[model samples]
Target: MVPPLVLDIDGTMTRPDDSVDPRFFDVLPQWDAPVVIATGKSFPYPVSLCHFMHIEQNVIAENGGVVLSGEQVTTNGDGEAARRVAEEYVAAGHDIGWGQTDLTNRWRETEIAVARDQPLGPLEELAAEHGLEVVDTGFAYHVKSPRIEKGLGLKSLAPLLDRTPEEFAAVGDSENDVSTFGVAGESYAVANADAKAQRAADVVLEESYSEGTLSVLEDLRERA
Candidate 1:
C-alpha cells in the first residue's frame, strides 16, 4: 500500500521563487497515495501547487493557520490580529513586506509575512506584546496566533482523508516543520535542513529540496 504524505514547499519542494525541479514531477507518478502539501505560503500559492501536481488532497497553509479542502476553507488563526501587527511594524519604520507592500500578502489569511532578513527579535517582542506568535519558515517570518501549528492542522484533516497522523509520512526542512514531524509516523528532513528540523525528523535524507523528497518517497514505497 502507498503511504500518505505531507510535504513542505519552500525549502523542501521548491526554491525561493517557488520553482520546482521537473524531475520531481517525473517521479510523482510512482507514489500511489494522497500527497498533501503543508506550507507557510499564502492560500492561493498552495492551491496552485495542488492544481499543478494534480493532487486532490487538502492543503494546510499559512503555517497551519488555514486548511483548504475542495471549496471549504477552515481558518484557525486571527487574520485581523495579523493585519494589525503588520501595520504596527510599518509604523515603527520596520522594513517588512506584506499585503500593503507585497501583493502576495493580500491572499494570505491568519498570518502576515515579513522578509526573512528582517530582525526577528523585535518581531517576537512585538508579537508577545500583542499575545501573538512568531515563526520562521526559513523563507520568511510569520506573525500569527500562538495556538496555530502544522501538526495540529495536519491531524485535523485526518478524518477527512480517513487516516491518522500515524498513517502519514511527512517531509520538511525548517523550524516551522518541527511540529509536523511530531505527528507523522515517518518523518524526514533534507540534508540542508537546520539542526532542529533534522533532530525532530526520524530520518535525514542524503539529498536536499525535491531530490530529498523523492528519496524519501522511494524509501517509503520500498518499505510498504
Candidate 2:
C-alpha cells in the first residue's frame, strides 16, 4: 500500500525556480494518501508549492510550529515553549525569521517565486555566533525563530489522523530536516544530506534534490 508522504520543497524537490520534476507529480497522484509539506515557509509561499505540485493536502510550516489547511492556521506548540525558543535564538544573536514576512520583498530578494525562501542564513556561523540552535541538513542553514522543530510539528499532526509518527515517511536534506527524519517510519535524505541527517535516514539517495527523492520513491514502492 502507498503510504502518506511528507516532502521538503527547497532542497528536496526544487533548485530555486520553484521547478519540480513533472514525474514527481505524475507518480504522486497515484499514491492514495495525503502529502504534507513540512517547511519553514509561511503564508502564501507554501500555497504556491501546493498549486505547482497539484497537491490539495495538509501542511506543516514554521518547521512545524504552524499547521495550515485551506486558509486556517493552527498551533500545536506550547505558548511559553515557543516564546522561550524565540528568546533563546535572539539571545544567541542570530537573525531569526519567523511568521509571515512581506512576500513581495522575499521574492525580490531571493528571485525565487515563493515566499518560503525568505528565511536566510549561513546557519553554522549564525548558530555559533549567537549560540543559537541551527538545524543543519547540509545544503543551507535555516534561521529558526523558535527551537520548535519540524519533527515535533509533524508528530502533533498524528492526532488529526489517528496515525503514529512511524506510519509516515519524511524526505528532506538539511539540519531543519533532522527532527523530521526522526518522526518518520522510513526516513530518507538525499546524497547531499549532512552527516547527522544522513546517519538518521534509512536510505540516502545517490542523486541530489528531485532525482534523489524519486529514487527513494522507487525504493519505497518496491519495499511496499
Candidate 3:
C-alpha cells in the first residue's frame, strides 16, 4: 500500500506570497489514500481547508502542538512555558503576533506562533531558557516544547489510521517539518526549501511549492 502523505502548508503547497495553487484543492481529493496536512499553521486553518476539500484525515497543527481528528482536538506540550516565552519576546520588542483572530489562543494549545522576521538565534536562546524549542516554519517561528514536534504528532495519529511511520512520507519546506521528515520513512523537500530542510530530505524536488507537491504525489501514484 502507498504510504499516506503528510504535507507542509505555507511554502510547500502555496506560493511565497501565501496564495495556494489552484490545483491543490482539486488533486488532493483524488488520491486513493489518506493525507495529513501537517503544518505549522494553527489548528483551525488546516482543518477548515480539509473540510473544504472534503478530505478526511487527522491534522497536525501548531507545529505539532495540537492534533485534530474528526471533531476531537487533542493538545500536547507545555502551554504555560510557550506563553511565558512569547511574553518574553514581546517584552523584548519582537513583533509577536497570533492567529488572525483574538480567539486563536483558545485552541493553539502548544506553541506561540509569531512572525519570522526576527533572527531565530536569539529567540532560540530565549526559548531554551524556558526549556522550550524554537521551530522555523518558513513563514513563522514557533516556540513550544520539544515533545510538540511534527514527528510526535504523526506518531500519535498513526494508530488511528493503522499506519506506521515507515508507511508514511512527508513533504515540507522548513525547519519545523524536519521533525516530520525524521519520522517519515520517505521525506521530500521542495527546491525552494531552506538549506537545512533540503539536507534532511531524502529527495529534493526541482520544482517549488505546490508543483513540487504534485510531483511527489505523481511519483507515489506510479509506484502504487
Candidate 4:
C-alpha cells in the first residue's frame, strides 16, 4: 500500500512563484492512502488547501503548533508567548513586515509568521527572551515554542489514523521541514530544497518544486 503522506506546502507543493501547482487537485484526492498537508503556514491555509483539493482535512499547521484531523484538533506551542515576542520585536522599532491588517496571521491560533524580508536578529532575540524559537520556512519566519515541531505533529497525527510516524512518508524543502524529515519513515527533499532539508531527507530528488512532489507521488503509486 502507499504509505500515508505528509506534504509541506510552500517550496514543496507550490511552484517557484509560490502558487500551489494545480496538479495536486487532480492527484491527491485519488491517492490510496491519506495525504496530510503539513506546513509552517497558518491553520486555514492548509485546511483550505485540503478543502479545495477535495481531500480529507488532515493538516499539521503553524509549524506543528496546530494539528487537525476530521473534527479533532490538537494544539501545541506557546502562541501567546510568540505573539508577545513579536510585539516586543515591533516595539524594538522593526516592522513584522506584514502590515497592520496582516491576514497572514489573522486566523492563526498557535504561532506567528513574520515576513521574510524583516530583520531576523531582533525577532530571534525577542523570541529567545520569550522562550520561543524562530524557524525559517523559505517563505516566512515562524515564531513558536521550541517544544513543538512538525515531527511532533506527525506523531500526534499518527495514532489518530491508526498508524505510526514511521509509517508515513514526507516531502519538504526548507529548514522548517528538517524535523519532519527526521521523523518520517522516508523523506524526500526536492532539488530546490534548502541545504538543511536536503541533508535531513532520506532522498533528495533531482526535480524541483511541485514537479518533485508529483514525482514522489508517482513513485509511491508504483511501489504500491
By lDDT, the best candidate is 4
Model 4 accuracy (lDDT, Cα):
0.90
The digit string of per-residue lDDT tens for model 4 on 1-224 reads 99999999988999989999999999999988888899988888999899899999999998898899989999885478878887888888898888879999998888888999999988998888888888888888988888899999999998898888888999999988888988889999999999999999999999999999999999999988
Could you tally the backbone clashes for each prediction?
Answer: 0, 5, 0, 0
Q: Tens digit of lDDT per residue, candidate 1, span 1-224?
A: 97888889888887545578666665654567777789988888888877776667489999898897666678996688878877788788886854355965878878888988777888888888888988877778888887898898888887678888998999999988999999988899998788889999999989988778878877777887
The Cα error of candidate 2 at residue 164, in Å, is: 1.6
- The CA lDDT at 194 in model 4 is 94
State the lDDT at 31 in candidate 1.
Answer: 64
TM-score of the candidate numbered 4?
0.97
How well does model 3 score by local distance difference test? 0.82
Q: Give the per-residue lDDT digits (tens) of candidate 3, residues 51-160.
A: 88889957998887788776667788758888888778768877566445735455676777767666677789889999888776667777888877888889888777
> lDDT of candidate 2 vs native?
0.64
TM-score of each: 0.93, 0.70, 0.90, 0.97
Candidate achieving the largest TM-score: 4
- Residue 89 lDDT (model 2): 46
Deviation of model 4 at 14, angstroms: 0.6
lDDT of each: 0.83, 0.64, 0.82, 0.90
Model 1 stretches astray by more than 4 angstroms:
15-18, 98-101
Count of backbone collisions in candidate 4: 0
